[model samples]
Target: MKNQSLACAEFSESQIHALIHLLSDPDHHIAQTIHDQLVSIGHPALPLLGLAERNQENPILLDRLSSVIADIRFTDVEHAFQALTTSSTEEVNLEAGAFLIARTAYPDLEVQSYQRQIEDIANILKQRCEPGLAPRQAIQTINQHMFVELGFKGNIQDYYNPNNSFLHQVLDHRIGIPISLSVLYLLIAQRLNVPVVGVGMPGHFMVRLKAEPVFIDCFNQGVVLSEKDCAKFLDKYGVDFDSHYLDPVSNNQILARMIRNLVAIYQKRDESNLAEQFTRLLNIVEPRE
Candidate 1:
């Protein structure tokens, strides 16, 4: 599997058969070879070949680990479109958001309307902030201003489940309430410059503020936190203060967390029909692995 060029005619039935098998190899050179072959042939092997390579396990994640490279190489939206389902979870939503944000940059896609929505959300948050509010204070003010003052019931997770615990517990049922709020918090806080991080703690998805003057928990309605309290929380959850346990998330990641929360909640409710929304969502957001 040395780094060498590949061609389409060079790819025989044997090579095609080994597509999945080669992807599992520790050395990713085989996968790169496949990519070279596709690019050489300029064949319409996108979406399928791209997704297979992405989802299938491979060591030392190569540049091709992303579905984006395939997206750029092939630009086949039709095949990708056919795979879509009704489920649009938060990560899927974020992925969709990325796609939309990109597509809307053009005059052809006619997604300009969404820009207004984004602007509206941003505008409301920006115009309605109290001067000199800390990140925690800002989140609380935003929540209260939107929830109680503006009557935003938001999504509540009264029920809980155990399966579908992918990156953000997309299948867990009990933690969806705070999960959704955390998603909103991350999205809104970024504009406020709060520097929120994600805590992928067992059985729960939470957020921590890294901004100065105070550490805070957005999941608990922007509760101001201390390192001591965080340590206690970790002890209660049986997770030490390991780096992975209390990581912050990005805007898209936050959105993905919310969708995952809903997926778990609905799946546990025995709503197979409803669960599909999240299942399809996972494919779009995380794209398998």
Candidate 2:
């Protein structure tokens, strides 16, 4: 069995070697043909290319191989994300959905690392809560920890940067767009049993206390807002006020909105490949004809 495994490994390595050589071909059509063949080999091509990349002295061949490996990694993430959409659970796991989206840009991201970061914040909030504290007071403590102490603010300077859409990046940089920040706030609030729900307001995202008439705008340092305030903000933006907009969105709906944001950003930047990928993800989450 060992010998057979070794033989198979050698065969795969030999195939990779031939493909790498053809990658340097002068003809564009030949190079594309070689690229397609390697990608068709799928995940198996990744390790072989990694070994070749380490030993390769040619810069052009190395660059081409790197691009191919990236595409393969992205395709793998895309497949996994699509599979999650068809999961048996009624509502998609929000953290998992966000992490899957993050993997598109950060293929090597450690999901547990981000989860731990969120848990740590929740733990601190848990410790800070006074025994039998009012729900509103408890929420204020969370806001102070998240926005003031931790300094998580909106990335208003570069609001359109695709990085703002990634949860992991938001955690690292302490800044993100409104929707990403709102998602982070919602997740932490849920962990702390604060009864917060995401409010997918038009052109703005926020959270609302389940039994209270209060809304929290996470992008603005968790400032509490009244329903009338939300209505006024919407009116100022020329969006008709709809009470339904304040309703708690499902995990799938939040994910669909995130995907839509990414699609718009990519399309604006003329990144058709990425835009198409997110569009497909959006369809999976909210299928349309």
Candidate 3:
């Protein structure tokens, strides 16, 4: 590794510039070798590669450079997730985990922008709720604000789109599948000091107040469901009812589910590359073996 680093360091800026051109080499083997060498040079090669990508007229070379850039960004995400998994902290930051996963596909995502968006939602909810309101009433107020007024809803038409797994997209578009919308609801509800927690039911996701009688189905416009209703919904879906399924999932579990959802979505679309990326991330974030 030391020798490889030294070799990479020996290449001057001019040499890196010239190597960028080699990406367009006619010989496949030579072009592949150049790609590998550029990647091995790591971050130092990014600027030169970016310049080449901008100026290069060849569509083939542009695609190759894009792949290399994606690989580098994936490495950064992998390391970030590794730190999250190996940290001494008791609870993972679910919001941060979601954004990190999103960044695998959206490398230029501005995390703080999304954070502010969530905070803004929470602030609106705070303003809407009256002081000393009943928990049930408070929940209703949140439902009205989030679902009716803000127009957030389940994307039934395109439920399988991978965008539904990303929090930013969920917020921006106001549509998502169960788990992502549940995470969004949980984040905002928790911020308002509501007792809501995510309930990762079989084949569905929802939220419920701790020790409360009702479940909030964010995907269904915060429809309130009883325990029996939850069981019936599970049975309707042909999923065997498990009492444990109604238990609140940990932040790590939530993150794992989000990634698993993306993996399934990509797999159905035959996007093997994306499926593989999320699958590897799932292993890191929720290692079972």
Task: State the displacement of the C-alpha of residue 202, model 2, in Å, after optimal TM-score superposition.
Answer: 0.8
User: Which segments of model 2 are wrong by more than 4 Å?
Assistant: 1-11, 27-29, 54-63, 130-132
Q: By summed lDDT, which 10 consecutive residues of candidate 3 come out lowest?
A: 1-10
Task: Give lDDT tens digits, candidate 1, residues 13-89.
Answer: 55544653454456657766654555444343444455565565644443453432433332233224323323344
lDDT tens per residue, model 3, 122-232: 998899887787888988999999999999999999988899989899989999998999999888988888888888887898999887868999999999999999989
Error of 1 at 16 (Å): 37
Give Cα-based local distance difference scores for all models.
Answer: 0.48, 0.86, 0.87
The superposed Cα distance between candidate 1 and the true structure at residue 86, in angstroms, equals 19
Clashing pairs in 2: none
- Measured against the true structure, the TM-scores of the candidates, in listed sequence, are 0.45, 0.89, 0.91
Candidate 3 runs further than 4 Å off: 1-10, 25-33, 130-132
- Model 1: per-residue Cα lDDT at residue 217: 52
What lDDT does model 1 reach?
Answer: 0.48
lDDT score at residue 202, model 3, on the 0-100 scale: 79
List candidate 1 stretches off by more than 4 Å.
1-140, 143-157, 161-176, 191-194, 210-215, 251-256
Rank by TM-score (best first) = 3, 2, 1
Residues 224-255, candidate 2, lDDT per residue (tens digit)?
A: 99999999999999999999999988888899
Please count the clashing residue pairs in each candidate, in the order shown.
Answer: 14, 0, 0
